[model samples]
Target: MSSRLARTSALTVAAVCGSALLVMTAVSASGNTAEEPRLHDIQGKTRISPFAGKQVTDVPGVVTAVRGFGKARGFWLQDPKPDDDPATSEGIFVFTGEKTPDVEAGDSIRISGEVAEFYPGGEEAGGQSVTQLTGAEWKAASKKKAKLPKAVGLGADRVPDAYAPEGKGDEGNIESLKLQPRKFALDLYESLEGMRAGLRNAPVTGPSTEFGELWVTADPGENPTPRGGTLYGAYDQHNGARMKVSSLLPREENHFPKADVGDELRGATTGPLDYDNFGGYTVRATAMGELKDNKLKRERTRKQSKDELSVATYNVENLSPESEPAKFERLSEALVKNLASPDIVALEEVQDDSGPQDDGTVAAGKTLKTLTDAIEKAGGPAYESRQIDPEDNADGGQPGGNIRVAFLYNPDRVDFTDRKGGDATTPVKVGDDGGKPKLSANPGRIEPQEEAWKESRKPLAGEFTFKGRQVFVVANHFSSKGGDQPMEGRFQPPVRESEKQRTAQAKLVNSFAKKVEAIDKDAAVIAAGDFNDFPFSPSLDAIREGGVLTSPMDELPADERYGYVFNGNSQVLDHAVTSPGVGPVKYDIVHINAEFHDQASDHDPSVVRMKP
Candidate 1:
C-alpha cells in the first residue's frame, strides 16, 4: 500500500477499533450535540473555529508539541484526517493548567475540551487571537505511536505574491477574509495558523540577539532590499514574505542560532505556526536546521576627497551628559572610524545636560562637550557644535529631555559664518543678499513658534563656508510617527497622522532652500537629519516640492538606499537632500548600527561627499 493509504488505514483502524473513541457527552444537562462536537466540526471552514464559545468533546488528534513550563501552559495537537480546504487549520492548542500534560509527542488521543479563542498578551496589545481547546480532558486511543504527519514545506513557490489585503475593512479581520493561499501570503499564513509547517533552505534576514528570535525569508526573496533582506513597501507589502522563528524549549537546549544577513538555515526547520506580541505570525520551532553565517561585515564608506566636502547625518537616540559613558565612546568610534569624520555632521535627539530631568534646563553645552571631547579622543577632528535649545518639555520627546537638532562641524575644514544668534522664538527669514539667498540669522530656528512645530523639534538653519564656497545647511528632526498606526496593525494602509506635521515642517525647510537658491542659483545647499519618514514618503515629497532640494539617496542603487531597518525591512528614515547643482557626489550609509545586537544607537548614519 502507498504511504498515504497506509496512514489513512492506520487512522481508520484507530478510529473504529480504538477504546471509548465514539463516546460523547453533553457539556451540560441540555444534551445538545452542538455543545459537544467533533474536532472537525469545531474547526469548520473559517479562520476561527465554528464551535468557538461552545464546549467540545471527543476531539481526537496526535500530540505535536508541549509547553509545560511557561506562563501559557499548553500542548498542540493535529488531527490525522484533515479537511481538504486549506483555509481551516487542523492543529489546535490545548491550554493545560500550570500542571504538565499527561501526554507525549506522537500519542493518538481523544480529548474533551472547551473550544476557545485565546488572545495572547491580552486584547489591547493588538495581539492575534489564537483558537484553542481549553479545560481539556483526554484519553489515549492507541499506546502504539502513530507516524507523525509530513511537514508542510513553505518554500518560495508556496509564498504568496501580496503581503496583505488592499482594503481597510478586512485588514485586521483575518478570519472574515476569503483565503487565497496561492495569491496572497497573509492569506496563506492565516490559513495555516496553528498547523505544523516547515521551511527548507531559508535565508536568515535578521538574527536572534536579545529577543531570541530569528527572522527568515525564502531564498531569492521577492522585493529584496540592498542588504539582502526584504523591503517593507507602502501598503504592508512585505509582511507575508518574512517569518519569525521562535523556540519554546529551554534556552540552553534551544539556543537560537546566531547568524547575520545572507546566512542560511539549511536542512529543515519544522514548527507549529503561532501569532504572538512580537512579529505577527511566528513559527514556534520544534526542530531547527543548521545555521550558516555568510560572514557579513560592517562596510565603511570611501574616504572623502581633499577638494570635496563630506557631510553626514546621525540620530544619536537621545544622547545626553547623563547617558552611559560607554555609549558616548562607541558613538565616537562610529563617527571617527566608520564615518571617516565628515566635514560637518547634523545630529538629532541631542538632549540637555540633565537629560530627562524636567527642571527646565534647555542648554546642552555639557552634553555636546562630552560628545565632542569623545570624538576628539577617538582620533577625530575637534568639532565645534551649534544649536538652538527648545523650551523645556515643549519638544515631544522624553519629558525634561529638551531634545533638539544640532550641528557638529570640523573647524579645520569649514568656517561657521556667524551672522547673528537666533533664539527659540526667533523666525529666521530668507532674504536676498546681492541676489543670493541669505539667512537673516546665520544659526537660527526656522519658524520655531509655528503651529506645525508645536511641541516638536524646530529645524536649525546655518551657513558655512568651505573651500571659499558658501554652503547652506538646515538640520532637522521632524515630529516622530508615535501617533501613526503600526505597520502590522489591524488597520490596513496604516494611518500616519504624524505625516501632516512632518509635511508642514518639510515645506518650511523647502522654502528656506528655495530662498537660498533665489539668492545664488547655483549655491550648494544641504538639508540632512532624521526625517522620521521614508525617502519615498509624502512628507519627503513636500521637501522636494519646489525641486530645490533633492534626495541624494535616490541617486544610489536601490539596495544601498536604506539607513534604517524596521520589522525586518531595510528602509531609509535618515536622509540628506542636496541642491540641484552639486556635482560628483558619493553617498554611503554606514551600517555601524541598526543590524547589530550591540548597537550604540538604533539608527545607522549616512554620509555624502560632493564638490561645492
Candidate 2:
C-alpha cells in the first residue's frame, strides 16, 4: 500500500487525461512575430503563470525530457538563453494529449499554445497547480542539437530553512504571492518549477515507495533525525529539504532504486522540477541516481522484566481471517520476537472475519483467534482477546471490514477483569471500588454516541490485573488524516481540517483517563493506540495538558520519537501515555515496518515497560 500522498496520484491521472483536448489553433505567421514571449515571460514571477488562459504563438525552448507513457503524456522544455531573474523559471512543461509529442531532447522547438494552470487533481483538491502549455502545436526551430541547460544545484547551500509563505486564510491560496526563493523552500521550489534541478548525493529520508517514488533531502542538516529520516517536529517546522523523486522513464523500462532510510542517491540526480498533487514538488528524473545503501537495520526492544508489565500498541492494518497467512505469520513473529511478547497488546484495525466483504459480519472472533493462534505458533504465549464490537457499518473504515481496537493479553502473565454489560453505544465509566478505581464495564466503549466519534472508531477501555494490582488501559483508533489538505498544497502551512475531530477525540480520551485518576490518584491508567496525529499536534497537546497523563515520547530521545514515516518525514502517530500513578516506564518505538518496504503494517509497534 502507498502513503497518503502517493494514493492521491490516481486523482492526478484523471486530471491530466481530461486536459488532453489538444486544440490546434490555426492563425497566420503574424502570430509568430518578433513580439512572441519567451518561456520565462510566460512563467512570470509568481506560482500562477501571467499568460494563463491566453493563446500565445511560438514560445521557444528545447525538449529536455519526455514522458511517453501514461494518460498525462508530456515533455519538458527549457530555454537555453535564461533571464537574470531567479523567480521566473526558464523551463516549462508542454502538455500533449493521448499521442506522445514528436520531439527529441536535443531538438530546439518553437511551440504555439494556450498557457494554462492545470491543477493536478482539480482546483478543489487544494494542491498546487502545474503551469503548462496545452493543446500545443510546434515546429523545429533548429536542426542542430542544442546542449541541455545546466541543472540548478539544490544542495544544502541553496535550500532555505523556512518552508512556505503563510496561507491567506480566507483567500485559501498563495498563488498570487511573489516568489522569495532565498527565504522559503516552497517559494524556492515554486520559482524553479518545471526547470532543470539537480541533487548530488541526496540522503534518502523516506524509503522507496510502491508507487515507484522515494523522498530525498538536499540539505543534509535539516532537522536530521538519528535514524536518517528528517524530523517533522511541528507544523511550524516543515522541513524544507524534503523532495519527492520519480523517474521520467516509462515504468517497464525504468529501474527505480529500492532504498531504505540512511541510503544515498549516489552522484548527481538531474531532473525537471514538476509540481503534482501526490507530492508537492517532484523531481521527474531524466538521469536517475544510483542507490547507495547504508545498511540501516531493524530494531528490537529489550524484553520486560519479570515484575514489570509490558504493554504494546500495534495497528495490524485491517487484519482479518481473509488476510494472507504470511501476514499473520509476519505480525506474530514481530509480536513475539521484535517486541518480546508484551503482556498486553492494544491492536488497531482488527477487521471482521469476512474482511472487506460487505456481508454485515461485525464480529472479529476469527480474526483475533487467527492472530492469537499465530502468536502461539510463533513461540509466544497463548493470548486471549477482549473487545466490544461496533454496530454494523457504524465505524468508518473499509466498507464491511468494521475495524476496531482489541486487546490481546497473555493469560499466563496477566488476568483480564471481565465486567459484564458492555455494548456498542454504552459508555465506559470509572467506578469506586472501596478506595480504588474500577472499570464499570470492562472492555467497554468510551462515549460511542459522542459527535466527535461520528464515523470514527470508538475508544475501547479494558481493565486488567497484573500481580494482584488492577491496571486500566484504553485502546484508541482515532479519526484518520483523510480529509486534510496536503502539506505541499497551495495553502501555505496547509490546513489540517481533520485536526478538529482528532482534538475532540483526544479531549474525550483525556477526560476518561482523568476520571480514572480522580477515583484513585495512584491508579495505573494507560491510553495508547493510533492517534493518527503528530505528537506535537494539538490533539496530543490536549491529551498532555493539565498534568493528567504524560506521553512516553517525552522520555524518549528527540530523534527516536517516531513510529510511523509519511511523505519521508519520521513522525509519531501511534503513541502511549501513562497516568502519574504509573512511574518510570521504559518506552520503545520499534523500527521494523515503517522503514522497510516489505512489512506487516505501516505503523511500528511501541512497547512501554513499567511496574503497575
Candidate 3:
C-alpha cells in the first residue's frame, strides 16, 4: 500500500487525552515534553503553574507515536499526574513532531497527544488545547528485540541512495539502496534495508503502518511570486542537507512537505524570500530540525485562525500631509514606498481634518485619502482611514495637528452580516479645556494635570468582521512626554496617568467587548494602539481591570519588546488587546535602529496576525 494508506490504518482510534487546551505561550516539542507545567506538552507531564503567565518552560515525556500535518506534526502522550494515574490521562496526549525529539515517555512502549483549550468550532471546550510539543524523546524498547538491516551507512559518496519503489521524485536526495521512507525514519534504527535507510513510507504502528507517519505536506507557492529582495532557506534529507532558495518555482500541489522536527524536510527558511536584496547568496535559518532528548520541537504559528484575520499597527510618528498638492503627492509616494501594506493599520500622530503641524501635515480626511489612494496607486486595493476629530489641546507646539490616531483597514475582513457603524464617538478632551464637560471617566478615572506641559489625548474606535465573527477595535494616543500635577508649593512629579486616558478608553473597549460578547460568546474585541507602557504597568493594569480584555502583547518576551531607547530599556506600550479566544497576534519589533527620532517612529509599530 502507498505510504499515505499505511499511516491512516495505524491511527484507527485515539486513546489519550489531557488538559485539552492550553493558552500556549511558547514553541512546543512532541516526544519528551516536560519542563514545567506547559500549555503544550505532547506525551509528557508537569506540575507547573497552569496560568498563561509561565513565560517559557519545557514539558518532559517520551516518544509515544508521531502524527503528521500538511507541513508540521504533533505527538501524543499523557502528562504525568500527582497520583501518576496513567489511566486518568489516557484519553489526552501532548504533541511533538518534525525532527527535534528531546522527549520520551517512561522508556519505550509509550505514547502521547494534546488536548484543546480554545479554537473555532470549539466553544464548550475551554482549558487546554494541545497544538505543539515542547519536549519529547524515545526510550529503550521493552520488547525482546527489534530487527536490524545489513550494511547500514544511510547515505554519502558510496553509501548508496534511497529510491522510491513507485519511482517518485527526481531522486536527487533519496538513497538508491534504501527500501522506502518511514515517517521519523532517521530516529528509528541507525540504518535500514541493506542501504541503511528505512522505507520513505508511513511509520510503523505495532509493526504495521496502518497509521500515518509524522510527516506534513506543504503546498509550495505555485506562482513562485518570489519577493523582489528576499533570501530563504530550508533543510533537507533527515538533517543531512540545507537548501537556500535561489528563486521561487511555480507553486504546485504536493510541492511542499508538511512535518514537525526530525521528519525529513525539503529545507527551512526565514525570508528575503524573493527579494533581490539577498540575491541568490546563502541564507540562514534561525531555527532548524532535530530531535531533542525525545521531543519533536516545532515552531508556533497558525497560518489561519478562526477569525481569519491578521493585523498590523504602526505609530507612523509624525505622518503629516503637505499643504502643497505637489509636495502632498511626494509625501504620498513615501507612504506607499515605506509604510508596509498590512490588513489593518492603527496610526498615531497622523494629520486629520485639522490644518498643518510643525513636523508634518497629518490632517485627517485628506491625509487618509492620500494614504489609501497611494496604496491603490502601488498595486494595492483601495482602503478607508478613520478617526475622531476633536479639538486640539497641544501644549503650545501648534494646536492645529495634535490629535493622535488613524486606522487604515480592509473591509473584506469584516463580516457585513453583523456589521456596525465604524466610527469614533467618545469625546476625550484633556487638560485646562477639560474637553467637553469632562468625558465621563470609565470605571477607574484619574484627574488630569493642567499646570504642566501636556499633549492632547483621544481614543479612536472602529468595527470590522473576520471568520463569521464581528469585532470592534479601539485605538488611542495618550499624552506623550512627561508632566506633573502642581501641588500646594512644589510640582508633584508627573505620574504616568496616561493609563487614565487608556483606562477611559479601556472602559469604552470593555463596553464594546461586552457588547460583542453578548452577540456571540466567542465574539472577539481588540483594543490596540501605542499605550507607552511596559508589559506590566499600572496603566495597563487599570485598562485590563476596566476593559476586562486580554492582550496579545502579554505573550511577547521582554527582550523582544518593541519601541527601544538608547539606554537599553524597552517600553512596550503598543498593544492589541483581545477578548475570549481572540489572539496572541504575530508581533515584531520591526527593528529600525537609530538615534534620531525620525529614523523610525519614536514608537515601534506592532503587527498582529488574525486567526485567518
Give the CA lDDT, 0 to 100, for residue 34 in model 1. 39
Per-residue lDDT of 1-612 in model 3, one digit per residue for the tens?
A: 123212221111121111111122222122233234422222222211122111224333333333332212344332222233221122222334234244332333342132221111121111112223223333443543222211112222322122112222431212122222232222111121001111111110000011111211121221111110011111011121111221122224432223322233333322111101111111111122221122222112223344457565666555555444543443333334433445567677675444454444343777678767766876555666656544344422245565567667766554322223322232322112121111222211112233221355455545566654445566656544333211100111213334554455445445545544554555556677766555565556656764467766556653344443311122356777777646445654443321111233455455566673
The C-alpha stretches of model 3 lying farther than 4 A from their native spots are 1-307, 323-340, 353-363, 392-398, 412-455, 484-508, 566-568, 593-600
| Estimated TM-score for each candidate | 0.86, 0.93, 0.40
Please give the lDDT score at residue 59 for candidate 3: 38
Ranking by lDDT: 2, 1, 3
| TM-score: the better of candidates 1 and 2 | 2
Give the lDDT of residue 428 in candidate 1: 91
Best by TM-score: 2
> How close is each model in CA RMSD to the real structure?
8.7, 5.2, 23.2
Residues 171-257 of candidate 1: C-alpha lDDT, one tens digit per residue: 344444555777777667767777788798888776565666778886455777656676655544554667878776556844778
Residue-level lDDT tens digits of model 2 in 1-612? 113222222223342321122212211111222337999998899887766666788888989998776667889999999999999999998877667888988889999887766676566767887778877899999999989999999988899988888866574678778889999899999888888998999999988876778899998788888878898887787888899888876566437788888899999898899877676788988887889989888888888889999999999999999999999999999999999999999999999989999998999999999999999999999999999888999999999999999999999999987889899999888888888887778888999999999989999998889998888888999999987888888886677899999999999999998888888888898999999998888999998789888987788788888878888888899999999889888889999998776678999999998885
In order, the Cα lDDT scores of the candidates are: 0.76, 0.85, 0.36
- How do these models rank on TM-score, best leading? 2, 1, 3
Ten residues in sequence with the least summed lDDT for candidate 1:
10-19
Better of 2 and 3 by TM-score: 2
* Model 2: per-residue Cα lDDT at residue 405: 96
